[model samples]
Target: MNTRSPWTVVICAAAVVTLAMGVRQSFGLFLPQMGPALDIGRSDFGLALAIQNLMLGLAQPFVGAIADKHGAGRVTLAGALLYVAGLVGAAYATDAMGIHLTLGFMVGLAMTGVTFTVMLGAVGRVVPPERRTMAFGIVTAGGSVGQFLVVPGAQLLLGQLGYHMAFIALAGLIGLAAVLAIGVAGKPRALDADGPAQSVGEALREASGVRSFWLLNAGFFVCGFHIAFIATHFPAYLADKQIPPAIGATALALVGLFNIFGSYAFGLSGDRYPKHYLLAGLYAARGLVFVLFLALPLTNVTALAFAAAMGFLWLGTVPLTNGLVSQIFGVRHLSMLGGIVFLSHQVGSFFGAWAAGYMFDLMGSYDAAWIASIALAAMAALVHLPIRDAPLVRRPLAA
Candidate 1:
């Protein structure tokens, strides 16, 4: 088999992923205005987002399975259109059910195409094995780039054109992601990444017996908690404490910005070191950061600085974790299996996002959520230790 141009693949992946994730991340910015416009409580807003996350996770396995069989171009193109439709629907949604259906189901369904597991599966297929981890890092970084750069810009656009127009504009940009997905065809041509390809069912069965896969899943639940809880609630948490809204936005964007560097750095590290140990350390570091942030005085500067540091470490684990999955399980059914693992991540996200809001509503403070994060992080660190980094014990694929 011949290799494709690295630059072309990387650039295309970055462009497409940035547009997709950029739009997704902007949802938080809308919360400030959206909650009021709809006559809903913050918990309601959180629940809607939690539903979106849940549907996103639930849809992933089927999407990944289909992508593994049918190639990603069609699915990606379809997802782009669905994404645009979902956003437009959201702009007009006047009731709770409308928001849930349009934003949760429709938008979440669209996310199946753009999310890291499926997107990185395509990346894993094209890039040589030696370059896979680094390549995945670069692509994942694009999503962060979108979050950091595009979100503030979207806020600016909203400033000028208003919320509805801002969303409409984003819909158009999301359509561009579909256009770019068409260009990512050299990889997943046959949906085969390794020498001997296994069926999706066979792959799942094989991986089910692996102790490490379950550990990875359990640990990833914590990751979801940190990401979604912060993404959905952090802004409000600061606002409740009298921090400026821009400060909140800035801190979140900072996470996206710094992660660009952190993701790449971790990917490079994964290339050389034991990925599980690195994963353990990343989770442990997350616990430490949260502990310190909660214990000290909260200020805009401290919040933003914390965001920047945490952001670097945030999505960085994705490349490392995904790389580890491919390393242990091979790439035959990588997309499907990886989707299952990510489902755990998203399940955690649902709870993280929902629980923070719920806790705040109940206690009038975010103390419980913060404490849970520290505990979950520590648990995730422990979970990573026993995952033996070896290939799945499997019967050969029927070829």
Candidate 2:
């Protein structure tokens, strides 16, 4: 079977990821406006997002397996349609239940098909082993690009056209992504020269028995918690401190901006360094950054600085984690295995988004959430140290 050029596939995968992730990242901007208009409490809105995360996690493995067998393009196209439908539904949603069905369930499920796991799996399969991490980094960076560009545009739309119309405009962008998904078509027929082909059942059985697989899942959980809490609540957190809404938008944008660099740098580093060590260091640094952000006085400058610092670290885990998976297991079932790992991340995301809002409503502060994030980061750092990152030596399948 013929395949597209590797670079062509990478670019297309990146574009698909850009739209899916960019749109997902901008949801935080809707919170302040959405709550008052829908008569939903912050916790209710947070629950919607929490449900979205859970659904995304729950759907990923199935979607990943489908992508593994069929192709990413079909799944992505389907996801784009669902995304548009969800946005339209969200636009006219009159109550929390409506919001939960549309924004929470539908969009979350769509994300499984459109976001990193499927696209990065496609990229991982096509690229050479040595270049795989950097390719994953580039695709992951594409999401950061979306964050950098889409969040501010979303804020602008929110300011002028209102939340409902903004959803329509974002839906249009997702429709465009459906076109890009065409280029990401085709599943890899065999593993690259480094390994022999393995059946999906064999891959799953192998991964399930490995301790490092679970460790990677545990470490990624912290990443999900960190990103989701910040993405969903940071803007509102800034607003609560009497910071202007525009600054919050700028801060999120900066994160996207810096993340572009962070993901790439880490991807490059993953090729050269021990990825688990890099991951351990990344988590440790996050804890340090959070401590400084809390200790410093609350101000626009400090907030933006924290955003830049956190953004630099944001999504860096994706490339390294993905690369490590490919390193340990081959790319034969990268999408499926990656989805399993990402499911854990999304579980953390569910808590991070929901728990923060729950605590804020009950205690009137996000202090507990921030403290939890710091602690989780520390734990993630420790977990990565014990991970065995060497490639698995599988015996050849019997004829």
Candidate 3:
């Protein structure tokens, strides 16, 4: 057994996720500047980001499989290097194609190794099952903290150093995560007491046969769509309403700040209450929040309020969803299974980013997209109701 303390593992995983998610979250802050700088339309820029989201989703299952086999630390280090390369390439990119290749594909691929799927799996393996949800929450909150702190810093960099230099600075921050990856090295030992150890193939075969697994994936798809659309287009949406750029930055920061509490609180709640019900409530709350935001007049106060309200709901699903997956399937192949669910998320993200841009261009407004998001949130709320949260009953292997 690797005898590393659970806290030590959590801290390192948290640090790695913080840096990875923080840098990724700040990408939207660049869209307004990047479009004008490259002389590209919003739809074109959105397409590039859409590709990035697609690649991120497409790569996760493979990356998760590698981490399950080879260990997370090596994969994380490689991801950090690719992340740096992608950012540096994007900084120098003069056209849509170059940015698409670097920011879209390269960066997206890099995230598969660095973000929630990998870090959460690392944390899940080390912590006891009873405490897993809270542990997952702690790690998820780290990403929110990154968003809280990093977005403002990115804005300041954009103000003082320009967008290209800002990308370089962000890349340097990701490099620091490589050092933290050392703590989560090596394959995880099994903690289940009853069942004989299962191979990755066995785990995958069992999970693929379950209907609840697909339900979880569908629910997560909604999460990706909501997050990517809001993160990528919210600032621009606010700007179109004639709000100041600072307000948009502040709104994003608030979302990050409040998400810290939301994630932690939801994680704690998942341990006591039924996670599926909590998830149902969360999506419903999102639908209600959108209704209020759209119905009320848009103001700095309303915008900030909307950001704070939405922030509390943001990423709350991550720990709960991941916890449910581990709870049902066992943690033997948690990373790979989690990645499979997240793939659906990334697919939704691709459409969320692309669709928003395409819709805005055609209709000259984001009203239609906002309404669609509201509808999806309601659908997601209902979709989680049918999941059975019991562990799979796998028989012992033949002697």
Candidate 4:
């Protein structure tokens, strides 16, 4: 029997992601400094982040499986150590290959253990079904909070200490999450004691056959693309127009700040409304936001307004998508199944991050990439329209 309160577990999971994701949100800030210093182009820098997103996706399911079998606490502790090492290594890296290996590969792998898959699974197991979406919202908001606070601080460190020292300083912040691991340290437990038992293999087979599951994946892919492209390149895009670098940082920080409200509000709504409809509306809103931003003249006011609008819509997808997964498939293997769905998101991220840079290098403007994002957002909104949120009904397996 567990002794800790459910909220205790939820809050700790939130804190860990706040640190893990907070530091990551600042990676784009490094490109201006790191790119010029190492003589690497934007494409190479973007490729490194693309690699990181790919590695992060590739490792997630295996890491999720391990967390499922052993304990999230142990997995999180090991990941935090690797996370610290990756940042420290990135700090000392002198070339593109070194950056890719440490920031792209190591940190990517490290994130699988510390971020959403493991942490949300921990929350899913502890909280009841009725409250799981709200709990997830809280955790997702924590990441945004990290974004709001750590990003500006990162910019300051860049000004005061340079990219190398900034990386080191970020490493120190992530290390603190290692101690918080104990809050989530345990194997997956029964959320509904009376619920039928399902093996991991059964869960996989059941989910694979469902149309809604695939739809969820399709929509989430666009989400990944939007996030990775904007997070990895938006600042540079602003800089290209001769906007001050500080506004770019402030803009990204505003996304984080507004998302804090967005995540919680969406989470609260998911519990009351049809999640599919909510998801569809959110995606459609993104398409509209992108279209308006592109049509308008670029300025400090426009950029910050864009950030605020996009931020509110940003991570709300996480809790809704995660809730959809749990709602349809059950949380028995959430870490693993959520990881699989997330793999699709990461695949989109790889392209989003890489393609933006590749396009910029070729075309010298982000207009094409922004157009692509708008189109993809429309596609995501359409895909989620047909999803049915009811749970799968399965016959009990033979003993």
Candidate 5:
């Protein structure tokens, strides 16, 4: 395997992220049925996930820093252990607090280790610079493959076995991810050819001075909100519309399926076109799609169609977004900067997950959540426009 093609790293890296996320995606499958089964409300469920995203956001920059200094393997292994522990804990969770601590905090910590912000940044190092967009896209596309492959199995297993068993199985799957992650051991790229290392504080000051950094941060917030709200609430909303939970699984799978294409396409486009404009159009289109879905019928057919449409727009942003960061900043501190931006995304996720639940708890529906997501999408589209994607000069910091 060490003698294998460089794409092998990309494949393993993406697969690792995919498998990790695939297992986590199943958590939503548990929500529609699990809440009632456990005598919890949507608020409780949402808060748990909100905490997870919060932890994920909080941990990302730190994880990114470590990946910057050491390598991704240690982070991935650590994350895999946390992931397995979280799922195991969640499987037997008897109270809302347990869910919050285990599923939320534990999973969040683990995911920070495994997610693409760190992994793909690592991939960015070895891959040729010209093909970076396509490479990032292809690696990210593997995550889509996980989403598609895992959600249905989760839904089906939930149907045939039960939620508890599903969690155990998912936990086992995460253990397998740890084994795969061991293969990720290798030499990491230097922070730069010139610099000894890029400190997080130094990275922050540099990234903060740049307009594109904040734009990327702000824009990523919407991606978090969009993903968290839908991933958490879609099934419940579908069930409200009288659709079977299975339909919810199918819709999610469609999102995964279409995302495979969307992510790669957008990644390719990012390489060929100006990335910010592409990002702007993507967010804008997402808003329109949300408007159409909310304004029209709520059938399984429509929901599945919406899922497919949305999926295409799904993580496709990741490659372009990550690409832009690496491009403007240089790949030296790519993981750290990307993680900081991803923190904004997770912050949005925290609100999206919790707010969607809180809104539903207050208003008796997800209409408010959908409307809010639309507005956020519009704002995100505007945020990226002023970003300067060109590289900034690295001046000596004040001693």
Candidate 6:
């Protein structure tokens, strides 16, 4: 029997997520500086983030499988080192290709090893089912914490240290998460199955057959699109309106701050209510928020209010979506299965990040993207309604 406390796993995993995601949220803040410095357009910078999101999604299955079979600690440690490398490399990069390689390629692969797939999987394995969603909320909130705290710090670094030295500083911060990897170091425990332990192929095949899984993926895609577009482009979008840059940073920071509570509230509620229903409501609320934000006057107060509202809704989907996955398919192969679902989310992120910039370059406004967000929100709200939230009942192979 394992001796480590479940909370230990949660704390360590959350800490790592905080650093990984915090540094990540800070990237959009870099675009203002990077664009002028590298002589690149918004689309160029957007493409780099697009590549990173796509690469992260593409690599997740393998990384999750590795973590599932071997141990999360090793995977996390390696990812942390690679994350440092990517940041440091991006620091020195002078061209589009160079930024794409360092920031897009290397960091993308690194995230698979460090972020939600492996970390949440670790918690799923350790925390009891009754408490699993709450644990997920705590971990999901860690990313926001990073955003709240790290984004502003990154802004300060950018203003003071410039992008190069700022990146180097960020590298050192993520390097610390490498050591915390030890806290999550353990292989998946054998789960109770109808037959022998399911092979990775078997897990894939089973999840593929579940209709709700695909629906969950579709819903998550909207989430990815919304977050990727907003996180990467929202700062610049604000700058276009002649808003002070500091307000943009504060707006993102508020998102991070409020999401902490939102994640926890949603996570706690998931344990008490129907997860799919909660997810549906969350998406619907997001749609309403967007509508209000767009309809209101564009002022700093309105922007910050929008951020706070969006923040509460943000990342709440993570624990809820993940809870649905675990609720449907047990945690036996949670990492790999969740990774597949997340891959769908990342694909949307690629489009969201790239498309906004493309639209900006072509149309001179983010109006189209914002409208798309509203529509996607409506779609996501509808999609989760049909998901089958019951646990899967397995039949013995010999039956």
Candidate 3: C-alpha lDDT: 0.90
Ranked by TM-score, the better of candidates 1 and 6 is: 6
Candidate 2 segments whose C-alpha is farther than 4 A from its true place: 191-196
Clashes of each: 0, 0, 0, 0, 1, 0
Q: In lDDT terms, how accurate is model 6?
A: 0.92
1-399 per-residue lDDT for model 3 (tens digits): 446788998898888888988888888889989999999888888888889899989889889878876778888999989999999999999999998999999999999988999888888877888899999999999999999999999999999999999999999999998888788887665552224577778778888899989999999999998998988899999999999999999998999999999999999999989999999999999999999999999999999999999999999999999999989987767788999999999999998999999999999999898999999999999999999999888787889
TM-score of each: 0.95, 0.98, 0.98, 0.98, 0.96, 0.98
- The 0-to-1 C-alpha lDDT of every candidate, in the order given, reads 0.83, 0.93, 0.90, 0.91, 0.85, 0.92
- Give residue 4's error in model 3 in angstroms: 1.7
Please list the residue runs of candidate 1 whose C-alpha ends up more than 4 Å from where it truly belongs after superposition: 1-6, 186-192, 393-399
Better of 5 and 6 by TM-score: 6
Off by over 4 Å in 3: 190-195
lDDT of 2 by residue, 25-127 (tens): 9999999999999999889999999999999999998899888778788988999899999999999999999999999999999888889999988888789
Range of the 10 consecutive residues with the lowest summed lDDT in candidate 4 = 187-196
Deviation in Å, model 4, residue 286 alpha carbon: 0.4
Q: What is the lDDT of residue 399 in candidate 2?
A: 94
Model 2 steric clash pairs? none
RMSD of every candidate to native, in Å, equals: 1.9, 1.1, 1.3, 1.2, 2.2, 1.4
What's the C-alpha lDDT at position 256 in model 3? 92
- Scored by lDDT, the top model is 2
Candidate 6: tens digits of C-alpha lDDT, residues 281-381: 99999999999999998999998999999999989999999999988988878888899999999999998999999999999999999999999999999
Candidate 1, residue 40: lDDT: 71
Which residue pairs in candidate 6 have backbone atoms (N, alpha carbon, C) closer than 3 angstroms, thus clashing? none
